[model samples]
Target: MKTLYTLGLALVLTPLPGLVQAQASAEPEIASYSIDTTLKISTDRKTRGVSDTHGEPGLELTVEAAHESGLIAQLQLGSVSRVNYPEGNNLNAMLALGWRGGNPEGWHYGLGAAREWFPGARVDEAPAGFDASFTPTGWVNTRFHTSYLVAELGWSYLTARYLYVVSRDFRGANTATVCGNYLLVKLPSGDLGPALDCYGSAMQHSRGTQLLDLDLSYPLNGQTKLVAHLGWQRVRNFRGLDTMDYRLGLEHQRWGLVWGAELAGASVRNRDLFIAIDTDGTMRQMEKPKLILTVAKKF
Candidate 1:
């Protein structure tokens, strides 16, 4: 009787191998993460409907990582135009950190901040013997580095984003001498065309510049979509430099590659404010309407 009792006790205390394995498999798994990369080549790199590539071709690479918990981080680097960022390294670098949540089929919201760095880029210094006292602090020699905060809201197929500049300048737009000055462009008719005041103030920093963007993407088919965008760039204290920009584009995905073509242009209060002068003294209107083409691959 005692031997029988001992055998029964052993059988009750030890779990079967199959049961143990089943219990282990039933436990929930930790959330997983993924990293993605994209490389792109485009006829022109435009920011807010203004050309950053001076109507030239550009290359860009981006890396992004996402977690199941709705956090994302991204880094992008691209080649820029010397005419657009005179005296600067022809490089455009941006780092963005943000969190996004909600169902893609429903509503979504996001908040982020980004910094744009243009290494060694600066505007021409104040004219010789110009009154230095009229300029704001660090205005004459500061590089073209800008930081901004962004907020986003969207539903299916439509989204709106607002970006507020927190930096001293908006891509070096608020230089001291350029304020209240006329941007003069010589016309082919041997005359100066329409001129407008810069409307910026020497004593003011461009810390409050803001951009509002509205975008729409409507699927035309399983692999192609119609994209449209409208945006306004408001330069605080320099309203004359404000612009309204628009884009109409189509994007298609096939064979693991994405192709895009867009018509982009901006209506500025004055075109001269968007004109870029190269080191060679040639000027290119950066906001003119143009067709931009792009191809990108993801990994």
Candidate 2:
């Protein structure tokens, strides 16, 4: 249930050394603070190799403010798929507060706290026909959300990040739905089998889920760069829900716009854990492999 959003890669990375830096000895006035806003459109909105838009296009707007002392605050808003948020969700929103420092040529670090909100979204039942014999008694009856703390460390073109979930559950993932789905397939004969007690507690929470990732951006030329990322997600108390995700891509920047294309996919351990059902009765796998294309403008 990792719901991290796709961040614009080209716009966020530091350009090739000396290619975009001002002369070291030149005395240029420095602003104490600045604000940046970016609007992006993409073929799909991916979070850790999973499509949040259910293989559809996505639109996003992000605003960030930073001070000379390294304090930063950011807000992100983006389109989401109804398949993944059936109850109702116009957009996904995230707010983060953090600090980043150190020379671009040397070591750098960032620490922050972020929370993702899916307004009006809820998962109260299994998809129709998914498990008619199963009761939805144990489902969490509230809006979905994810809260986590992030820490990052980087040197030049390489960075590493770790996210630790602090909420009662990671997104909407819980043992109740997982176990219920398990019984659906395991007991196709319609027999209760080993009884409810054999399935363990149905009320377990996924509070300590974690994500660790490494990102690389190497300049292929002044206007183009090679980008890659690898990430692993571990769901605490749910070993079967773990996954590994990957991305490899190229990005180019010109004419005040950034363009990118990436091959992204994931190795999902449990297919039922991340399935989505559309309004048309379509069942979708959110972790499929696909090429993602994007264009973004920043001001």
Best by TM-score: 1
In candidate 1, where is summed lDDT lowest over 10 consecutive residues?
1-10
Which digits, one per residue and each the tens of the lDDT, describe model 2 over residues 1-299?
Answer: 11223443232334686675433332334447778899999999988988888889999999998877889899999999866665666689999999999976779999999999998887675422123354444434544688999999999999999999999878776655555444544454565553243245446778889999999999999999999999999988777678899999998998989999999989988775556656654567789889999999988
Taking all chains together, the TM-score of candidate 2 against the true structure is: 0.79
Question: Distance from true position, residue 175, model 2, in Å?
Answer: 2.4
CA error at residue 95 for candidate 1, angstroms: 0.7
Question: Per-candidate RMSD vs. true structure?
Answer: 8.8, 12.3
**Inter-residue clash pairs, candidate 1:** none
